[model samples]
Target: MTEQVSAASNAAVDTISRAGWGAELRATFALAWPLVIAQLAQNALHTTDVIMLGRLGPAYLAAGTLATTFLNAFLLGSIGVVGAVAPLVAQARGARDIKAVRRVVRQGCWAAIIISVVMIPLLLQIKPIYLALGQDPLATDMAEQFIQIAAWSMFPALGIIAFRSFLSAYDATRAILVITVLGVLINALIAYTLIFGHFGFPRLELRGAAIATLTTNFIMLGMMVAYVLRHRRLKRFNVLVRFWKPDWPRLREIFRIGLPIGLTVLAEVGLFTAAALLMGRLGTDEVAAHAVALQLASMAFMVPLGLGVAATVRVGIAFGRGDIDGVGNAGWTAFVLGLGFMAVSCTLFLTAGTFLVSLFLDMNEPTNANAIGLAITFLMVAGIFQLVDGAQVVAAHSLRGLSDTKVPMLVAIVGYWAVGLPISYVLGFVFNWRGVGIWLGLAAGLAAVAVVLVARFAMRERLGLMRSRA
Candidate 1:
């Protein structure tokens, strides 16, 4: 039964891969919306933490913000590494190689586990790292406390990414959405109860938030694992049947494709993390404001991020089938969708900057005034870069569909570190523009990368990016 269903689904995807732009648009939208909502819900878990901690005061908010920034750098980097599963599985499915699909997923799981084991210890060293960077002593101490507990969540967190990548390639995103939305709701409630000592819970404050994050990731991972195993269509792959087996070549392949991806993600995320650290040097309010503004920008970014995921699947499938036209259609269609949504978001950020930032801080509290004001300013700048940020991510993911990551990784390093970071430091410190200056630098970096990536995709034929099609 599972084999029959899988065959039917693959046939449909094959048809879609050869279809026209209109058909491709519909397929991408079908695959993207649920994933978009899931991404938003996933981000909401952190947004909830930021909101809850905000009520505790700038000190707590600052600490939690710093801790999460540090942790997410590693978490997102690992996710990028494990995320190679989506395109790999998509390609295998396109080629009608179910056995290869299973191997890719199993190896992906191995990659996720290995990454978690390596990252947890480094995550635990947040205090020393922050102190070395000259962050506030109180905030650093509190951030370290949060990291001690939160670092362990990396296990379940990376597990969820691996499963999500597997499900995404199969176009089974509705399950991903349902599971993630439930996780968000549960996380918010747990965070509220524990952070404030409500419903007979202890007010663990920062610790409570950390626990909420850990608990939510575990639940989400379990739910994902159960879905993949119990769903008739998905279980046919038997992804974990030989759980103890090692496929060294497959593992190496994942790393080969995934390491640059991980570094690319780290470069972009690290750019923002570095910006957060730079803000910390200015003042607590500055870092706090940066967090709120960054969260809003990140939430809006989820739409394009989801579209990018869809592009990877669509393009990967097309690549596997040697449909160059299909690859172009998929990539361009996602680019259009991403740009359209970001234009809308850009307007909102520009028009409703103050109102959106207010959601994270208490307007009634005088102490929050500085942070709130700074957040509004930062958000406006974020609005300006929305289009470019959306462009770069989708373009990068589209290239991933073609297994064109190494160059994009190099592009990111150059655009971000060589171009963006220096501009941020000079403008923020040397020129004394402070937080706004740093954000402007972010805009520049995203814009630079976007231009290069979009051009790369445009020249795919000339660049021989399609030569690897199976």
Candidate 2:
């Protein structure tokens, strides 16, 4: 009888383990594929702009690239704060609490607006700082003009993100994919027309790219808001009912969770932006090469990024449902998927890097050969870090699902700013290793962060399971 009981227990444990991993893999990729598509579409806007401007020459490419570096640092980081709502919404869904979910959404909108306002002065100040940092005056001037047009779109952009988080939590992933495809296609056509002065539009060049991007932001915002306002299913959430009412406590809670997230994002972005700035000190050719490599890397990065976000939703829901094992399962599953995908990216970057670099520049142009050659080298460096970068981002998002924000924020500071930046400066300038050294430092920083954050989530998962059992 004892032998039979032991055999039964072993079988049960095996079944549960299979079930956990199976659910996590299916659930995670189900949501992640659509998210990856949406992210790719959104990033393609920048890619399209860069490709179009590349036709004008390396100088034009540098202008758009330089402007986007600061824009990504400040603007994209602020949007990351808005994403804090995803976990909150997912938790609410798991608990079957509609009112709590709606409350978070409305509060998030207000936070987005407030944050957008704070960003204006910062965006306006980019040009002066770029000049002081000794960037090419012509490229800096072009970057300034792009910011002038692009800055105003921050409000709607953040607003779109708020709704996006809400929708993702409820598994409304298809909505974003549809809207994102439309936005990117429209932006590309409009950008081509405006940049080339076709269809009666004046040739606006780099500024036209800015305008095209801004137009898409507004379109996305309007579509998302309209869906929220009119959808019969979503109406019960009452997202618009207290549209103007302020909930200070709720707002404070979001900021408490979100500011850390924003700062974490800011630190990582700042590291790369700083590197871009340092490259600027080298020359326009180096900056242009860095730009192409970074853009390509960012494009491939969206896949792991989307998977990481899907993990946040999965883990948060599992947490709310009081399934601690499920949280670990979801987190680990996503991490595996993310790292796997990036490894494939690594192989591509290693094998066909020159061919990939050729897509962004005119190979026949003798002037661009230097920049293209430099980009291929940086692409190889980028390939080396893809696995670690994927793992770190996935781990960070998993932690976010557990309302564990502060530690990861601190880790980002230590990893990126302290460990990464100083090494970059020492190797690139002091040791005269140049651009390659800066990218090496970046790889070291990502590896450190991956180790730290993955360890944090592992510890947290055990603690959460212990508490649940208690």
Candidate 3:
């Protein structure tokens, strides 16, 4: 018995030691690189899908764009609801509350499942809405089929995200990297085989892409579940069993914190999706150009997105530890790093905008001349926004670290809807400025969000520090 107690005590100490870095630059990088790699892998799969679909036909390309928009607007928001798990789990780690940590994760997974079930039907209903919105019939039909198939994967994908959030909050980022890499690889292989009719499989076209993504999600979910089951740390919780024990109070707490963030995410996505609609009205080439520009911008955003995730973990842990200075320092570290990266991206795009745009589109075709022109203009606009985009995401994440979400939603509504969407519509249609005008509106909105979120974080940090002192 004494020997067993000694072993258990050693294990507890090890877990605590692994919970965080020492607030040093090197230590921060050591914690952050894995997250960056995971984000890169995820982005690579998205880029690959676009490249492959672009090769198929213009209809396929357009369908992919529309389908992706629906996925982000609907299913992605639901998953964001579970994103509340991260800071809470990280804080629990900081406070050494193992039971609370496990409970948060388990309830989060349950919430994700419920969310996925709700989202699947909403995605199915989007087809009629697309038709109602006057999307080109062929494009709308292809997008509907793709969304229907892809929406089914939300359950598994979100389950994977829930587990990933659990592991990452404990600073086990390597597991996330491993799982995401495997999923991306599987997606690539399956997408290639099915899309091209390889290995005696029938060519499934757009459906193949959807199936590949779906299969990859299932594989990721299984891998995460298996990891949790076999891992020593989670074995105590009997995660398979414990994950189902619904804690109503914790669920309410999670909803209180998460719903606003989810809505804020939805609101931002709604703005961009609405911009896509406005672009669609401009013409086919312009819409395609908009899609290409958005894709590249998304790729660029991954760096800041990963940094934001790291910032949330670091800030939450620091807050839990009552280290006000450490929280502010971590936020600064992530923000500076993200801004520096965006500066590099801006320079690269400015120098090679045409060349970069050409890579994703067929510039040699006369049909693409308008697209090429529009894409370059949009890329230029995106270059300006990337700076503010990075800053705002980091700022919003800093607020997440303080477990604040409500004010950000209000900021998103005003910044994106009240300001950005109206400006986009006017410049694109009324002023006839086209895609560039719409993009300028997006930049303005992002700048607004950046300023507001930064101020909000500063205020919250002061209050949190005061409370800690008290």
Candidate 4:
């Protein structure tokens, strides 16, 4: 482990020398840690849902997992639209263009609201789709109910993301962090009380979890809206200034950049969601295992995701400032941090995967043993792709900062769907590798994406396109 750390440190030092030291690590970390904590808190909130559902037995876990998987495939994919806020606002902030920042945030929020409205109907239809796909009728029915209740949360969730992106771009991450902590606490308490019928609440099971999540979404959005409206500096952006103004050109620009990001996110998330659905076809136990392993992977992924957020800001700012060296430094530094962090995660997954997966299952429940067993297998394959997953995500976000979305989107389509999905289907079904094969396919896809994405960013730098265009 020490030697691994030494090698990772040496690699970072080497990257710093080549990339130059203009993008400050200290500044980046300062901006990044709070964001990381907030992301962990959010994932922890979601994992809490998994843990709570898991305790109810594999049926409950499988049902909730399947439903959320479907909803997230759409919800997160659309969120790619709100993601435009960070880079758009950061670049505007870099140029100290107050009007541009305000316009972007307000317009971005409008975009989120519009996207949320469209997502609701899609979520409402999850059950029929599940049935059409031949999922267990009982599980499909329960999942459908869950999505119906959960669908309402998307409106506020989208709003929160938009505002959160705006705040993150400005380095005002702490307020968002505090609210997220409160949200997790709220979600945990509400989920527990309602799930177990504690504190005189109804034991609505899956419905209770959705209600808790939805309730948190509303409150979090309220807090975000309030914060933006009241915070001295944030208020200066006038995010809430005019609710009905039309900025046709700016909205078009945002959609132009954001649509590809949305598709890219959709493509990647669609792969995993497809994997989850495929696991369901195998059995409840398979789905349960896949859910557990994916949740852990997601938790670990927050580090890179947060770094990616920071990279978007730092690199976007550098781009706006016309700092060629800073763009290289920011992007490379984030890649180093993200990959190095995931290296530690890979070690943990490799060394203690059984124990980690065990936390999501009840060892005493004999029925859950299957899930635990399958999850252990998946974690090993998950560990294999940790570095590459980090590589792709970090590099992708850096490109996003360059406002380079379309090509990256194309790269993702080819990498995840073209390469990853086909391979997963072949290995899992064709070769009969089953659970393990599905994960291997994911690893392969991510590895391909990592190679191509990093190379793409490198080429952009070499050609001076990122700097010259900015």
Give the range where candidate 2 is weakest over 10 consecutive residues by summed lDDT: 7-16
Off by over 4 Å in 4: 1-15, 18-23, 462-464, 467-470
Candidate 2 vs candidate 3: the TM-score winner is 2
lDDT of 4 by residue, 1-470 (tens): 34434543454465578635643787788899999999999898789999999999988999999889988898898888888888998888778789998888888878988898888887898877888988899999988878889988888888888899899998999998999999999999999998889988779999999999999999998998899889898887777787689788888888999999999999999999889878877888899999999999999999999999999999899888887767778888888889899999999999999789878998778878778999988998888899999989999999999999998899999999999999999999999999898999999889888777777776675545575545
Better of 2 and 4 by lDDT: 4
In angstroms, give how far residue 233 of model 2 lies from its true place. Answer: 2.4
Question: What tens digits encode model 1's per-residue C-alpha lDDT throughout 216-243?
Answer: 9999999999999999999988999988
Q: Give lDDT tens digits, candidate 3, residues 200-253.
A: 999988888889988988998998889888888766656567456789988887
Distance (Å) between predicted and true CA of 2, model 4?
29
User: lDDT tens string, model 2, 329-444?
Assistant: 88878888898899999999999998999999989999998898999999999999999999899989988888788989999999998899999899999999999999999998
Native-structure RMSD, model 1: 6.6
- TM-score, each model? 0.96, 0.95, 0.92, 0.95
What C-alpha RMSD separates each model from the true structure? 6.6, 5.2, 8.7, 3.5
The clash number for model 4 is 0
Q: Pick the candidate with the highest lDDT.
A: 1
| Candidate 4 similarity to native, TM-score | 0.95
